[model samples]
Target: MPSAPSVRSPLLDRFGRVHTDLRLSLTDRCNLRCAYCMPAEGLDWLPRTELLTDDEVVRLVRIGTMRLGITEVRLTGGEPLLRRGLPGLVARLSALTPAPELSLTTNGIGLARCATALREAGLSRLNVSLDTLRPERFAEITRRDRLADVLEGLRAARAAGLAPVKVNAVPVRGVNDDEIPDLVAFAVEHGYRMRFIESMPLDAQGAWDRDRMVTAEEILDRIGERFALTPIGREGNAPAEEWWIEGTDSVVGVIASVTRPFCGTCDRVRITADGQLRNCLFATEESDLRGLLRGGADDAAIEAAWRASMAGKGPGHAIDSAGFRRPARPMSAIGG
Candidate 1:
């Protein structure tokens, strides 16, 4: 390997954004096969040896926190709950000096059983993916009949003190877009923050088409017809543009990642389950952090490799451009 840099720099990309958040995927294996995420048959699971051990994950997170100035961490997965002893991982992360504001993004399938345990272990927040409110539509979109379980999980999360729980909805043009008002109502009634995200090109089945994506503008327009929404500005590095309801304290957000990319202010990076570090979710290339971790390299060398990867990050993901191409890995493998 080339000589290490004289000093380890913070994870700053060429765009001048200092990254403080890291999305760490514990496993690429999920329980539900959402239509936009994977095929009905599911994916071939990775071998046990290929995944980073719990120790390795904690070590990398410590390096990111101590050496690179990352102050936030989100544990994601094909389904993070699928990983064994996840609470233990959360406890270790919570014990870090200046412990990161830790969170998790899940499908809410398994959360009902372990929500209390995870909260007790120091998990602070959660974002659950729920596309449709109707049971039939949920089954149709996700190819799973576990909407009841998901609802139970949401309640469990709230009861466990995971406050300000958020719901992430990806509205497809002809799919769940019609349920926007209903979804908003559900979120408002349940005291959950709902954000509509435009569908991106990360499906494992390669079925994403621009014509089928429900844009953020369309979502806001539809919601406006039903509710009085006043535009509200969001705080630092938040991917959503929020709006507060006129009379009520309820609020909604829209993540226009496709129509209006937030790459300029993106303070986030992702590490895949196998240890590949990606500066952007739609990146066509990934740096192999697993290799260095298992090759007897010290923390400094690993940090250098991470810095090298972020140094080349592009200005934007360019999803609306003609030259755009979807990544080989799907959203599940890349984490939420």
Candidate 2:
């Protein structure tokens, strides 16, 4: 006879966004080749067998939702859409106890094809990473000529009733920095919020020129001329400086990870597709939870492991102030 499994109680952050908001990376695979993110050359991706099965992920999330007050879940990937049957997984994760709010972050290339199914399956919201709206520039930035596809996907997501969708613009100084105002305008017209994130040192394998970095404060200053920007409050779990323009319907957020560090309010945790628990995105160390999961550890065992990982989290990363060099892991390695 099989033994009964152990259970973990609900978890919460200091900011109260339920520490259960799991960033479940489905695969370390992506199709786009953005200069700021994935490498131009092909990467050595992990084998398929090494990935967590869809069922396994759903089960883990379900347990978290039931015991640990997990009310929100965001599915990310090297490109989440690359993983087939993703909507099925979304449906599964959406049906969890009290039910988690299901959302996803995608480059939007494959989203047009999957948006309808995703909406039907219980996806509540979406955040698309769109740096440029120009066709040629889109190809130049992402190393892929799929701007049309991404735009179509955005339309589909909106039509599917995934309201309040977000667009993330990672401005890398001279690269897509000019697109900031364009993105803000687009967000205003479409009723979606756009977040401008300062480039960080997550791209380990590639050369990360911190000198080419553009801080969130700079982005806000540039756009302040067109729209009157006012500070907005968050639940405190999010690290972005939120501002809303009075006349426009859109909201702008600045993720000043490099300039204004918010690690003190860092309460989120990341779980790789293979189950390695990462305390901080910029931290070099991570704890192994895959072994424990595969060994049939009970819920209490899993909860204890989560607590231990949380305890090990550093106060914050010093790459910005300490003049530290970039780490070895790429941005893709750190999910969306």
Candidate 3:
């Protein structure tokens, strides 16, 4: 017999935005501490007991799709591949009906080893974070020298047929800003979509000296000097503003979350490692869904909590407010 339709309320949020893309943080652990995400010293990670079990994550995802209209599921973390047996988790998440898009965001340190199994387990695409191509610069930025391993992972991802692999870069002025043309050229040559991200004040170590930020406008201008950028219309409330450089089947994107806020078109809801439903990246608040889930809250209740949080999502973050602070926790704790 076919399953009964859930008796939940309408899926559209108060913003009239339906929650379609869910960014699930599988683990708080990271192998590298990028300057933008965590403190230089270290941070106290959450106790194991606080994290949701794999089964708990799947249960929440089912409710999100069944009652809340979530259609895209992106697994993220400090580094999701750092989590053990993620292919199993991916396989389990892939089996959910309504069939949301399945993908992952990784630092690519371990992806070299796991890409094949993960692809077989049903991951559809990947966004790999690669800031600098120069091995020495990479070591300086991430405090680790594994650029070769990450390169192998990118190749493995392509070989495994991961479509539209995105390379995300956090452009810190004077640090790696000189490489825009080279980076764009590299992406075009490699058939990878490259995204230039403005450094936001997400953590203390990122230091986020406003002067050091290379805005999207500058990035585009520099690229425009080299290649003609034809803006492409985005689909279904997507995040990045895409522009294709003429004469190639390649496109470079700029995420203007910092310089040009796109909150009105925002359709993302983040689930932290501990299962708190966060509406905006800069929000000082978090709703504890894991408490209710582990405390015997049914799937419907979980769905309702997520709906309310998304419904309550602010039109945008208040980075300009007098009291606005970079969130107290590092990006690692918050799930970058």
Candidate 4:
């Protein structure tokens, strides 16, 4: 077992970036098989015994918030809603001292049923993945005919008062690219903030191609044709470049991870469901926190290990570089 450092500090990389946001994956088991994320047949899910218990999760998060300087916690997953006792987990994380702001990103399959429970349990925000407006197109992209369920989930999230319900849409060039305008319109109509993300290279099949991605410029142009867009610029460490939809008070955002990488100001770090810490989303390397957590390591030791992992973070994901390589784990396994 490693001993704790004499002095502790915030999670900082060598490049001078301070990580305050934690994307904690509840489970790697998702209900949907989105083409960009998972295979149609689904994945070989992690064994139940391998996953961090609810108690283990709370302990790590406590260490992150009380010891380190984590101010925000985003619950993510293959689908967070699939995690049993989610409301209880959120309540526990919310009760932390210093109390990190809590949010969740989910496929929205079962959100309609539990959005209120989650909100009452202290979840403050939500981001639901809805790739297209058309049911057939949605089925085509996700390989599941559950568009109605997702839409209802969004509505339920709104009803539960999870304000500014953000909708995340990934516009694949030949697939849902044409629905960009409609997607934005739907968001605006329903008082949801729409976010368009470029298709990344994290696809399980390793079939991502730059040419096949609908660039940010193209996405803005598509929305521009119908709605007037005024730039709202970007806020601190946020991955999205937002814009006001001119007439309405609502805003739309685009996460151009490929065309416009924001690694320089990144303050986010991720922990996969099975307890591996990833300094970067596109990282090919990971540090095992599970071993330490289960092997009787002290809290200070865990914090020290976390700091060491971030120390090795590179300048960026380097997707545009010719030498760039996709991570061994797909988006589903790694946590979106």
* Predicted structure with the largest TM-score when compared to the true one: 4
Span of ten consecutive residues with least summed lDDT in model 4: 1-10
Residues 130-247 of candidate 4 have per-residue lDDT tens digits of 9898899888888889999999999999999998799999988888898999999999899999999998999888888878899999999999999999998998889999999998
TM-score of each: 0.97, 0.92, 0.95, 0.97
lDDT for each residue of candidate 2 in 200-319, tens digit (9 for 90 to 100): 767635667877888777798778867898788654677677888878766799888877887776656777777777766776777677777788877667766776666666667787
Candidate 4 residue-wise lDDT at 97 = 78
Instruction: Output the better candidate (2/3) by TM-score.
Output: 3
| Each prediction's whole-model lDDT (CA) | 0.91, 0.77, 0.82, 0.91
| lDDT score at residue 277, model 3, on the 0-100 scale | 86
- Report the C-alpha lDDT of model 3 over 258-325, residue by residue, as the tens digit: 77888887778888999998887787788899998878877666776777777777767867678666
Compose the digit string of candidate 1's lDDT tens values, residues 140-193: 989989999999999999999998899999999888899999999899888999
Ordered from best to worst lDDT, the candidate numbers read: 4, 1, 3, 2
Clashes of 1: 0
Please state every model's RMSD to the true fold in angstroms: 2.3, 2.5, 2.2, 1.9
After TM-score superposition, what is the CA distance of residue 264 in candidate 1 from its true location, in Å? 0.6
Clashes per prediction?
Answer: 0, 5, 0, 0
